[model samples]
Target: MLHQSRQSITCELDAGNSNCLTITACYAANLNTERSDLWVDLINVQQQLSLDSSPWVVGGDFNQISHFSEHSLPSVNCYDSPMSEFRDTLSHLGIFDLRFTRPLHTWSNKCPSSRIAKKLDRILVNQPWVSSFPHSQATFLPPDISDHAPAILNLAVNLPTSGTKPFKFFNYLTKHPLFYQTVLQAWHQSGSIAWDLSHLCVKLKKIKSDIKKLNRENFSDIQERVRVANRLLNDAQVLALTHPTQENFLKEKELHDKWEFLRTIEESYFRQRSRINWLREGDHNTTFFHRLMQVRNSYNSIRSFTLSTGEVVTDPVVMGVIAISHFQQLLAPQTTLTSPCSLAWFQALSPFRCPESNAQAMILLPSDEEIERMLFKLNANKTSGPDSLTSELLKAAWNFLGAEALPWEYRSKDIWIQLKQVSEHTGSLL
Candidate 1:
């Protein structure tokens, strides 16, 4: 079985480099032999090919014919089994047998009386190597002295000569100074820091008022205008080409730059408001929120929280109480009986639910009293003795006081099977 599986050394030509890769098997066999040695030789050849980094082509007596039809002469012991196995082996290795056009017979009978001729000798190449040189041709050269004729192969080689283009950054901006000046002027005219800050706050308040107004006004139009302007400005810097001297290009640059500046201001204002709204909504579970929480926790824990700027802070709670009192003074005039409290004040006092939800769904806010009650209930339920008040409070806060949950629903077997299949196909963990 080992002898039956070995393959012979093969030579391959790289059509791209005219480089030749040659490999040979450990064993050799004659035409009249059992061909078990040829099999072993072929297997070894395959193993060698796998180890080889260079392209390869193999050609030799092969001892076995590739096709039954290649053996035209009548022989009493002719068998198709060897030919079929050879063809299968070639197919399995992804090797292609070269087609011969002239003097097709690769082997001839040594004896004059037998007059047998067979195309047993063949040339093969790795399929990928052949694709680069599709014009390759194989032919049998006339025998000089031996009965076997030498196979001749010819192919063309084409090599790459040049590298790809390099990248340029300055090509993104317009060459004209007037257009450039317009963009700069727009940026400058945007407003001073103090003016912009005040304007940003005012715009944010207006946006909130617009949203709260029960009238059927389409704020989406204003939002879209702001969005479109910002997009134009963001892309203008990328679209402006500095090399060209076309009038149309300058006009386009000027138009886009103006629009971009307008959009940028609007976007900046909207972003500031969005951040304030996000804080007010207590959407602080994200990384930014956690970072702020860490800072606050550190401040609360440390009695002396000093700054790197040589400012010493003594009695942090006293300062915090003072700040809260100042904030309350400012908030009272704006605060309505139904208005939601700021996140800082809301969290600082006992947690109180704001009646800001629609009639369909109610938002739950747990009070400090309710938190204490839940903590007591959780402590009573504990089987172990004497759990700390902090531990009990934490457990209650995480469970009942955090958020609402829906009742459990069972899925059908088919749905579960489909879900599992989808998860497996998409490589999803859930």
Candidate 2:
């Protein structure tokens, strides 16, 4: 134990593998006047010991709720003074509520007639603590006998490894300085084939390989890069301080700039993967994004499925087979149509017949400008097709692709059919 008081006790935790953490178990006073002192005391501990950027946790009954929704009782005033004070204290200490599971309300008044429930007990930590234990969760057990529920913190370090996943195009890659040049170079290097559609597919496939290489070389280990940059910056600062030379100061500045750049890139990378559109960039929301990504992966995972024979199957291989069989059956051709539609049937529908001029226009080959407009209309952030080509990549290399020559026999009708097939399925041409 590091510090002890009537309201709180602080301790240093050593969880093996050189991972040390400082924890504080606190119980604030019921009265606002006395509870104010507890807040000050906790802040004093934090400031005096310089624990701002360290792995630290403070958990216990705060004797108050931070948000209005936390309490069952509604009030005319949405912002309560006591709640505001508690929130401010936490904000000042760089502490935020840890992600939790199980019971939402931790404390109840236990009154059957007019019961009051509030989330007064919470585990809070700083950014450092979250980074150290990214998958940690606090589970609040049911308050059986006592009014306050017991909270258990689990540091889930082990994560299940997944197999090779399909290629996905991230929007942030477009923001890279070398993106446009690298893609254009690869596009030209692929050259053109006899068929226009085949030529486009070949170019796209080539660029996809180049893009993968670019990511592997520069962007794959972003978090590790951030750590290395930070370490280098710290070392340079120390050197400048000890030697006080011009060269040392210049080196420190360069390293500081490099660290900031890498940090920004890392933030953008996770932000795209998180798929959160509301939150804007530059908010230092990387920790939230990282946790959210994990949550999404867990939610989307298929652990088990029930078969048609009233049996539950958890084996992955069996599940894959089941999925394949289901899709194959669904997509199999149907011969049950009593009367298949023919050209005469379409001509009989005079009310829905196309106009003569419109029919002629439709048959005419699509111009480069028309095709470019359609390509630009595609959603850049959407997942890549089976060809591993994204809308963003197509748009970026349009200058080269739009000028490519096509055989004179190719008609607009054939191109339109192919385009429709690409849109509906794998975005690949036959």
Candidate 3:
């Protein structure tokens, strides 16, 4: 056991090959004021131990409900102000309830008339836990004598694997000096026959392959690299202290710089994934960002849903089938009409038209300078589109491509598309 208090107790479970798991058993105070301390203590422990990469789980009675739906009888306003502290703490710690089986309410008041039930007990885990135990789940067994149900956490649940994950462009790659070189090399290898939109599409596809190679080579084991770098830096510092030699001091400094560099990269990695813009860089917020990403995944996931036919669907395949069927039915043609309107009826309505100057401006072909400006203005952190093209790639390749003018074949069409996309992206910032 690492630490214990009235509210919580934390411990670490060690496995072979340096794999470790952290677990915390929490039983929070019933009152909001006392519960706040639990939140602070948990956050402090996490920060102190630097357990960002370790699989961690915190389970038991939190004496808190995240949402109003968790309560059998909710407030009229549908807002619980005290819940914010608990939610924010969980966000900061990156803890989320494990998807569970049946009986959502874990605790109930044993009252015959004025009965009350709420999800006061939960098993929450961080992102690393989810990654390590992808099919893990919690089940709330029926309560016997006690009001609270016993929660069972299964770490290893056998399940079919999901298909390929979509490709994403990491903005941190753009900071590396070799990134541009890699893109240029890929572009040369994918030499285009014609400089048109079609050619750009093919070139981008080729670039995506090389970009993946770059990530695998340099950035794939970022967290591991950070750990190794820190270890090396610590060893060098110790050696420098023991030897007190000029060479040893220089070695320590070099390793320290490398460690710092790797840490920055790790921070950027999680920060980008967290999609948190409020917290600026240089705050040592990698842990917070890491947890926030987990929270987002937990929130966005669709573990189970009920169909219109009153059948509960837990299987992803069946859920998808139902979703598609519903959307198809909902969007299907409501009426059968060969001709809904005639030209004469349309001609009776006054045509709303923009000024000639505005119309011309809307269709104006974008210059290379204008396109370059908009591309640079885009958020490089955003994931690449289905085309596997990102703002970072375009900005880096722009210098080489800017010398040539758009091909006359699809110049207007391509330029308009490029301009529209870039404008929309940049406008979003405003």
Q: Pick the candidate with the highest TM-score.
A: 3
Q: Rank the candidates by TM-score, best first.
A: 3, 2, 1
Listed per candidate, the RMSD to the true structure in angstroms reads 32.4, 8.8, 7.1
Ordered by lDDT, highest first, the candidates read 3, 2, 1
- Global lDDT of each model? 0.45, 0.75, 0.76
The list of candidate 2 runs beyond 4 A from truth reads: 73-77, 165-207, 222-430
Residue 86 in candidate 2, Cα distance off native in Å? 1.6
Q: Is candidate 1 or candidate 3 better by TM-score?
A: 3
Candidate 3 weakest lDDT stretch, 10 residues: 421-430
lDDT score of residue 220 within candidate 3: 86
lDDT digits (tens) for residues 1-430 of candidate 1: 1122334434443334565554342223665354665655565666855723334566677777776557756552455776777777776666656544445677888778867778777777654344434445565777889888886776641221234422211111222234334333433344332122223223222322222231123223444664676576555544555434466467567767766544443343233322322343223223343333333332233333234564544554555665567678986555557867798985788765556565334434445556545545542212222211122223322332122111111122343554443332211111
Q: Which lDDT tens digits does candidate 3 get at residues 1-430?
A: 9988889999998854676788899999988999999999999888877766678989999998898888998562365678877888898997778878768999989996988889899998878887676667887888998999998987655542355765777777876779888887877788754355545555556677888888888888899999999999989989999999999999999999888877888888898888887777878798888777766655456667665675667776776777778877887646666867987787668677679999999977766567667777887667556554566666666666444324455455555575454443323221
Provide the lDDT at 80 for model 3: 68
Winner by lDDT = 3
